[model samples]
Target: MPTYKQFPLADTAEGLTEADILSWHVKPGDTVAVNQIVVEIETAKAAVELPIPWAGVVTELHVEPGQTVEVGTPILTIDVDPDGAAAPAPAATPAPASSAPAEEEEMKPLVGYGSKAVVTQRRARKGAAPAPAPAAAVAAPPAPAPAPAAPRGGYVPLAKPPVRKLAKDLGVDLHALTGTADGGVITREDVERAANGTPVAAPTVDSGTRERRVPIKGVRKMTAAAMVQSAYTAPHVTEFLTIDVTPMMEFREKLKKSREFAGIKVTPLTFAAKAVCLAAKRTPDINAVWDEEAQEIVYKDYVHLGIAAATPRGLIVPKIRDADSMSLKELAESLTQLTETARAGKTTPADMANGTFTISNIGVFGIDTGTPIINPGESAILALGSIRDTPWVVDGELRVRKVMQLSLSFDHRVIDGQQGSEFLADVGALLADPAMAMTY
Candidate 1:
């Protein structure tokens, strides 16, 4: 007899309740091997690829792409014994509406499985017929007009719940509009185009492009929530310092040719990170967390430095583990690898956890400076501004020098104004003269 196996959504990270099915690599009837990646899912924290535990032939897919599935729900089924002898047929019987306890008991938890039973109900199919009424019930009122006919080849459109809601709100019939997505799945953009009476194939400006609305989910949704929590929960105090970083800029040029830093692509941000690490040693309280529930301040001994990187999805901060312990060459190499992994959308949840302090390099985008909100757990954040050539008074002589601005935002409940100002000044001083970092 063939053994049927169901693959449940495992806990990819802590506090992950659900994940969106981004795409499928294997379909029904496809032969798969153990540990082969079969699907990709996007959770609130990161995008992860799931591997099948047992080698088998895919029997059925229980979930569709773009659908959010709760943890522990069966997303796909497979037959482990494809060549096994067929079992004797049973007498004619009606299948139960819900799975039996025997079937549930047969489910073996794979490695990393988070839960045992499914928690979410699958959505009902669009235009499904109502269940038959009891004989004693009165005749139901006449059914409403049937939905607009499906597209060619009698294909009904596939759309997510939000897109369906948008179509209904705009008085547009989804079945009538041709979809531009893969496998005739309707998207929000398709519905908006239909509402504007434009051809779904070609969306042009002539169709009155007033505004475009994007649904927030995944990374964008998580980022929004974190920002709101950080802004409201913590009292923030921002202090700015303008400094001439001419010495630091010159030091970077010399370091580029040194054999110790030969392969590293050194930049101003690299020097800024080094300076922060060195300054953090002098001001250890700056690298701390506010423990609200515990009613105490938690000062960290080491730094898991968070370098904020903006991706196509949203802002993600992947940390460099034990950054204070690494040399400048090691820091530069780790920073390069961490950022490349983050931008490529491969940063894992663990890579983002346990950050002691953060740095937001807004200078990359030509931004001068802004009061950056603190990362959720961390108490302080440093923002680096654009480097420009400006006239400065050096020893009472006006000369052109490389100048940059630094802004530090700290949780006022944990750090006083004096402490925050002193921390910012130390960072500015180190950056203004790279050799000053050694004195600390």
Candidate 2:
């Protein structure tokens, strides 16, 4: 019998149960190396590429692009090698007997470290193995290795690992496709062309809805569950405060050309974020979370400030670590970096963890204000509103200027009405007169 090894999915990050397989990298009969990107899966926060643990000729593709797989379900199979003739085979675990139902089976890697590590196989690093056999010939697998991508032309292009895999799975030549955007780089559309039978239109989706529903697998499934859980568990208290932000508007204009805010987008939210951090500092209780398991309150010393962004998959809050220590310019740059990462689905798991406070800048989407929900584990969140011209009284005279609203949502259990109002007032005061922020 030709022995075969199955490569099951594993939890890529904490609290993650399943991921949506956005795309696959290799097809049946194709040679793959250890650490080679086998698939791209969309998690709640970003799209991440997962590498194959073992090197081998792909004997079967168990899931198609867009299928969601559980954390330990086998998505594909590879032929294992021994004696350096083929790729190292993943260690095998005896299957649970037939009486075990699909849901009852452990949908995870076997828990033991040595004898139970599912998919313990490793592969040869790039350039370490001898050249593969000719395209038409049966080739020996690469040598033993751990998984790891070379940096391309000064920039790692933003495609997910699965996008690269999609090209491979569809037999589409990735290098042949031309980038429609800057520097002529190829995109997902380029590889998708081969999958649809006709050449793909660059940067565009297939005309009309020959709709495809990718099974919600990895991150998407985990994220949806988390959002639903948070929505139900938290007792949300939302309070809105609108202010004449004309002064803040003027402050932003002055900062844009100033050296202190050099090379940064001096938006009201940047100032709002700084204000929130300062306010949280003054109100320690609101900055803390209820650790239900430990039966203790956890107060974070450093702020992992989360910025909520809506991506194609869903809402992802990628945090900016130690945001309190950064200058206005630094915060602006970080915002830009996180936004791009969120859009590309490349923000790592580390980027999404440890958020002590969250800011949902709905202003960018041109909304005035909204009663926002508190992110689970965090006690408070602020919604930054849109700036628009409105008539307001200043020094007993009415004048038209940029005005905006701010909404602060806090956990009522930890934060009283007085404290929540004070925090909101502090954020409003800073925006109304940003020069006042120097005191903190």
Candidate 3:
């Protein structure tokens, strides 16, 4: 008997309810082994690859790419006993007892459930026969040509998952364009060019309908909900401070050429991160969370610092766990890795949870400071503005100095105006003078 198994979408993270199918690695009639990656899905936090637990021939894919599915919903089906009794008469013959262990090993349980036993011996196809002799060789009639293979009407374009997703998002037809990459693979630039060349037919001089609509789902939907909740629930208080950071900028340049900080990214954000961690020691309220159900303020000793990153999917904040304990070099490396991972859409839900404080580096966009909403579960958020040279008074005379702005937004319910001001001032002071960290 052929045993058919359905693979459901499991919760990849805690409290995960649903996900969108990003892509499928296998198609119907493809053979797959246990622990083989068969599909990729995008949850609220990150994109995750799912392995099929059964070693079998794929029978069907239940969902298409970009389709959203709830947890426990079947996404694929496989026939674990593809060479079993359902095949030709010879396939029904029982295998020798000695081969049982091999079957068991091939069908080993994964995650929790065990699939059907694997059949090692492949049965011959029905009606298969030896070829006849050629007319020139044996003076007999030539063998008829083999039947043509079934037409593969569904031609999948050669592109990476990210490129495919980008094409889909831009409404670009991948099949219409020629790939310029090696092996004729599609690249991100190819998709963008195609999108740019596409004609827009909806907009006209007479028609008032010119807006495009996109369904809010996945990370974008989750971020929107979080921002709304945090904005309405937490009474936000924002404070701004502009400071001359020439000393810190000079220190950064010196460290970059030094042996201790070689190959490390010691940017203004890195300084801001270290400042926030050190400042939190004196003003712990900046790292605390409000417990609405318990009616108490929860304070944390360790810092899980979150750096706000803007990615193609959406804005995500991945945390550096226990950041306060790390030295300057360690913090720089951690920040570099965190930003890269978040931008690549690989930041897991666990990395985004339990954050103590957040730093939004809006300065990267070349903009000055703006009031930023605090991330959910965190007490305060800081926005770092662009650094530029400005005239500043030193002792008695004016001189050109690197100046930047810092904006801090805090939950007034848990953090008073004084605590917020002190925290912001401490961070600004550290940036204004790197040696101030030694005093902390």
Look at candidate 2 and tell me the lDDT of residue 276: 79
For candidate 2, give the lDDT. 0.69
Candidate 1 local lDDT, 84-186, one digit each (tens):
6645223243224443311222344556645444322122124643333333222322222233443568554677656866898899988787767654568
The predicted structure with the larger TM-score, 2 or 3, is: 3
Model 1: what TM-score? 0.78
lDDT of 3 by residue, 1-440 (tens): 45566676776645777888999999989999989999989888777778987798987776678766766555676778888754433434544543331111222234532232322212224474332222323422122223224434775556654576689789987777666665456778888888888432322333576655565678898899999999999999999999999999999999999998988999999999899999999999998999999999999999999999998889888899999999989999999999888777778777888888999999999988999999999889999999988899999999998999999999999899999999999999999998999999
lDDT of 2 by residue, 168-189 (tens): 6777655556555433445666
- Could you tell which candidate, 1 or 3, scores higher by TM-score? 1
- Local distance difference test scores for all models: 0.79, 0.69, 0.79
Task: Please report the TM-score between candidate 3 and the true structure.
Answer: 0.74
- In lDDT terms, how accurate is model 1? 0.79
Taking all chains together, the TM-score of candidate 2 against the true structure is 0.69
Single out the weakest 10-residue window by summed lDDT for candidate 2. Answer: 99-108
* Cα error of candidate 3 at position 304, Å: 0.4
Per-prediction TM-score to the true structure, in the order listed: 0.78, 0.69, 0.74
List candidate 2 stretches off by more than 4 Å: 1-4, 43-46, 80-116, 119-224
The TM-score-based order of candidates, best leading, equals 1, 3, 2
